[model samples]
Target: MVEDETDQVTLDLEQFEETKKEDTKPTLGDIFTDRVESLMKHRDIDNVLDDQQHILNNLEMMNEKLKFLNLISQSRYEASVTAFRFHMRLLSGVKKDLDSVFRRIRTLKTKLGVQYPEIMAEVQDKYTVHVSDDDDDE
Candidate 1:
């Protein structure tokens, strides 16, 4: 009977060990959860470096764009203004030349009128031109 009791105790110890092992063993879900927790706790340096590189590239592109805009504002705008001023001066000189030409033509006509008064009167009577307001009843 004593030997039977010792065997019974040995059997109970074996069963307890099996139950303890079953309770402590990790499942697939437990392992996945532990990995995710570990990853969350750790900081990855490569991602931070990538983000910094992106910011630097964006700033460089913006700097190049600003340089192009400055070129247009400085050289192109100043050149346009200078060209406009030159054209205006040229137009003014042309106007002065045209005025002098018209004055010379008027003086020549007066001299011809003074030389032949009777012939000018005959031509004027034949032409019969008039300047009217109301556009000739258009």
Candidate 2:
């Protein structure tokens, strides 16, 4: 009876050890599948990062182009303003010259009327004749 009890205890201990080992064992197929899934996830993350980086680079390039265009527009505006100012100055000078010429003509007409009244009258008559001739032609 004692020997039979010892054999039964040894058999139970062996069975317990086998159950523990079975629980700890992972299948080769499960390990391989897990590794493949991990690799796919890593590749997806890498692709996403690459796409983000590409978009950022394009945006940076576009920003630079916009800045360049803005500078060009500002320069063109300044040039246009300068040209307008120059034209205004030229017009002012022309006005002054016209005024001077008109003054000179008026002075000459007054002097001629005082010094040579008969000559001025003859000139005025000739001017009226020329105007009448031009009106008939029209």
| Candidate 1 segments exceeding 4 Å error | 1-56, 121-138
Assess candidate 2 and give its TM-score to the true structure: 0.46
Tens digits of per-residue lDDT, candidate 1, 1-138, equal 999999999999999989987889888998999888777644555677789999999999999999999998999889999999999999999989998999998797688879998987887788867868957532
Q: Candidate 2: misplaced stretches above 4 Å? A: 1-62, 128-138
Can you write out model 2's per-residue Cα lDDT over 52-102, one digit (the tens) per residue? 999999999999999999999999999999999999999999989998999
- Residue 21, candidate 2: C-alpha displacement in angstroms: 25
Candidate 1, residue 117: Cα displacement in angstroms equals: 2.6
- Clash-forming residue pairs, model 2: none
Prediction RMSDs, each to the true structure: 15.4, 14.1
After best superposition, candidate 2 residue 85: deviation in angstroms?
1.5
Indicate the residue-level lDDT of 126 in model 2.
80
lDDT of candidate 1 vs native?
0.88
For each candidate in turn, the TM-score is 0.45, 0.46
lDDT of predicted model 2: 0.91
